[model samples]
Target: MDKLDKQSRTIKFFRERIPAFACIPGCHDCCGPVLASSVEMARLPRKSEQEQDAALAALSCPHLGAGGCQVYEERPLVCRLFGTTPRLACPNGKRPAVMVAPALEQRVYRYFEQVRHVLV
Candidate 1:
């Protein structure tokens, strides 16, 4: 497969393998400036400087909205992996009981390496 295809499949793998948990409702303590590949950031809508400043002031992600992540569907792998791994545990203590499978976790890291160069 090509790089694009591999990236897409890797994203799908992450989505399927990573466990999900219910974070504290309306609590965006974990949302903030995130380092992500240009490809991933391109999937999200751009934010104005004012909005970015506001989000930074509030200690929340620029994409965060009243309900939750405004760009959740296309959220980056880092966001998807949040609360699923011990290394990046949820600050709000909403981690899932079962962690991601070791093999899958390794694959996630591998993919991160592949994209790390392009990450901003």
Candidate 2:
């Protein structure tokens, strides 16, 4: 398989994996502490954190606010990968974990445009 095919498979794999952690909509703080960022060092909350502060902290997405996920357009990788399995412990003291699924990948990419916008 070529590089494009390989990448496509990877995206498909992740889409299936992350959904294991289905994120309930309108839950206020679906993603707890350490909201995913694109600027610099923004690591997904490690399972080993033991204690996740659990606060409605500011997320890196320009789209996130009182209204929630605004930019939806220019979001980052992690946001795209939100709802996975193992339900990354809710930093907000909630149990049943959440996942992030932005359905943009289902569409085909342009010839010159290259990016896994969908199956992140």
Candidate 3:
């Protein structure tokens, strides 16, 4: 689909914007063991590949430390798309809404839905 690159780009944009706008300059556990998705395993950079199997087995990010995401750039979609709020829901119902950049989710989901084979 022509949307592949664009959608990934969009996910990239929101991925950055979401964290920069919300959880910056604070203690963020975005890379914590609790919320860190299995997706993180697939996104780990090649540099960390040797540890991927171990990390996945432990379910602890190889790049994660006492501070935060060591390889934030190579973080997963869930990490990229996380919001500062404790929880988020939208008028769409079903899903609990919280404050987040609307355009960001749209872009991220676009990529996720389209390029299921690749990282969103």
Candidate 4:
């Protein structure tokens, strides 16, 4: 397969490996400016530069809506990683029943290091 396909598969693999959990009602404490791979960003809805700047200035994510993450289903891997690992624990003390293993977390980080990421 080509590079894009490989990256997509790697991302899918990581996404599936990470555990999921419920968050405290109306909590978005972890939503903020974060780096996402270019492939990941392409999956999300486009936002204007002005919107991005405004959100960054407020220390928030441009896709974060009043209710919650507007593009939650297509959120970046880093966004999905939040509250699923000890290193990125949820402020509300919520997490998956089984946190991501250190080995797997490190692998994900390595993937991040290898990929071209852009602030979103």
Give the range of the ten consecutive residues with the poorest summed lDDT in model 4.
19-28
Ranking by TM-score: 4, 1, 3, 2
Off by over 4 Å in 3: 1-8, 19-44, 48-50, 84-98, 117-120
Model 2 ranges with Cα > 4 A deviation: 20-25, 28-59, 70-87, 93-120
- CA lDDT of each prediction against the hidden true structure: 0.76, 0.37, 0.50, 0.90
List model 3 lDDT by residue over 8-114, tens digit each: 56555656566433344434444444232234344554435556556656666566666766766766666555553234422222222444566666655565555
Using Cα atoms with residue i matched to residue i, what is each candidate's TM-score against the true structure? 0.78, 0.35, 0.51, 0.97
lDDT of 4 by residue, 1-120 (tens): 999899999999998999889988778899999999878888988899999999999999999998998988889989889998879988889999999988989999999898989999
- Give the winner by TM-score: 1 or 4: 4
**Worst-scoring 10-residue span by lDDT in model 1:** 111-120
lDDT of 1 by residue, 1-120 (tens): 887677767677778878887788887777777766666767778888888778778766788878888887888778878888888888777888898887888888887777863322
The residue-level lDDT of candidate 3 at 42 comes to: 48
Give the C-alpha miss distance for residue 73 in model 4, angstroms.
0.7
Candidate number with greatest TM-score = 4
